[model samples]
Target: MSATTDASRGKLIIPVLGRLYSSLHDAGETVLRVVAGAFLTIHGSQKISNPFGAAEMVEGLGFYPGALWSLVLACTEFFGGIFIAIGLLTRPAAFAGLFVLLVTVWFHWVTMSQGFSGAEKSLLWAAILLFFVIRGGNRHSVDARIGKAF
Candidate 1:
C-alpha cells in the first residue's frame, strides 16, 4: 500500500482499538457491579438480621452512636446494593456506597495500627461505585432497557 493509505489505516486502527477497549470496560463494569452488589447485599443482610451484634461490634471499636451508625450502614449497603443490582438510580446508589466508604475510611481506618485492614475492601468497592457513577450501567442493565422503554 502507499504511505498515505498505510497512515490512514493506522489512524483507523486507533479508533477501532478505542471502541473495543470501551466495550470491554463496559462489560467488566457490569460484571463487577453485579458481583459487588450481591456481596454487599449479603453482608448487609447479616448486619440487618443482627443489629445488636453489629452495634456491639461497632461499640467494641469505640465508635460513638454505634447503634445508629451501624443501622445506617446496614441499610445503605442493603438498599444501595439492590439499586445497583437493578441498575436503578445507579449513580445515587454508587454515591451512597462511596459516602459510606469514605466515612469508614476516615473514622475507622485512621486510628488503626493496621492502617488499611478490612476497610480496604470497602474502599475498593467505593472506587468501583465511583467508576460506575461516571461510566453508567451497560446495555445489559435494567436501566438501559427500561429507561428506553419509558
Candidate 2:
C-alpha cells in the first residue's frame, strides 16, 4: 500500500499524518525562508557597497557590460532576499534568487572547474530557491496578507 494509505483497511490515514504535516508545514517554510534569505542578504549587501566591484571578474567571464550585470546581481541578491525573508513578493524573489544561483552553479562547476566541491553549496541554495518558487511563502507571509503573489 501507499505510505499515505492503510493496507489492512484500504483507507486514507488522515488523522495522524495529516495533523503532523499541517503542524510542521508553515514552520518548515519559515525556516527555509529565513536561512536562504539571511545568507543571500549578506552576500548581496557586500555587493551593494560597490555594485560594480565584480565588473572586472564578470567581464573576464565574458558577461559584457559587466557593470550593469553586477548591479543587477547585487540588487537581486540584496533586495530580493530581504523581500523573501519578510515573506513579501516571495515567489518572485525566490525566482530571482534561483536564477542567480543557477548561474553561480555553472560558474563554479564549469567556469572555475572546481567540480562539485565548488558547485555544491550553490546547487543546494538553488534547490532551496526552487522550493520557494514552487511552494511560495506560507500563510504567515505578506503575500497572504496582501492577497496577491507573482
Candidate 3:
C-alpha cells in the first residue's frame, strides 16, 4: 500500500488524532517556515543595525572583503528572513540564508574545531533553509496569494 494509505490506515493508533493531523499538515509546515524565518530575522537584527560590525569576524572566517561580506550577511539575514517569512521570493531568500548558514557551519565545525556539537544549530538552520529552497512556500504563503514564486 501507499505511504499515505499506510499512515491513514494501519499505522495510526488514534484515528481521531490522525484525521486532525491530516487536516493540519500544511499548517504545520507554515508554522515551521514562519518561525524559522522569524528566528533568523531576530538573530540578524543587531548585526543589521551595525551593518559592518561583523567585518573582522567574517575576515577571520576567511571571507575576503570582510566589510562587503559582512554587509551581505547582514542584509541576507535581515531582508532574506523577511522574504522567507512572508513567502516572497522564498526560494531565493532561503538560498541566501542557506549560504550564510553554511558559512556558520564551517566556522563552528572546522574553524573553531568545535565539531557537530557547536555546529548543530547552524546545521539545523541550514537544513530548514534548504527545505524552503526546495519547496518554496505552501498555499498559505504570499507567493500563493500573488500566484508567483521564485
- Winner by lDDT: 3
Lowest-scoring 10 consecutive residues by lDDT in candidate 2? 1-10
Question: lDDT of each model, Cα atoms only?
Answer: 0.73, 0.86, 0.90
TM-scores, all models, native as reference: 0.69, 0.85, 0.92
Model 2 lDDT, residue 135, Cα: 83
Question: Which of the two candidates, 2 or 3, achieves a greater TM-score against the reference?
Answer: 3
Full-model lDDT, candidate 2: 0.86
The TM-score that candidate 1 achieves is 0.69
Give per-residue CA lDDT, model 2, range 14-85, as digits (tens): 545655665676798898897888889998999998999988877877788999888988899999999888
Indicate whether candidate 1 or candidate 2 has the larger lDDT: 2
Single out the weakest 10-residue window by summed lDDT for candidate 3. 1-10
Identify the leading candidate in terms of TM-score. Answer: 3
Once fitted onto the true fold, the runs of candidate 2 whose alpha carbons sit more than 4 angstroms away are 1-18
Candidate 3 achieves a global lDDT of 0.90
Q: lDDT tens digits, residues 67-139, model 3?
A: 9999999999998988888888999999999999998998889989999999999999999999999999898
Q: In model 1, which regions exceed 4 Å deviation?
A: 1-23, 56-66, 117-119, 148-150
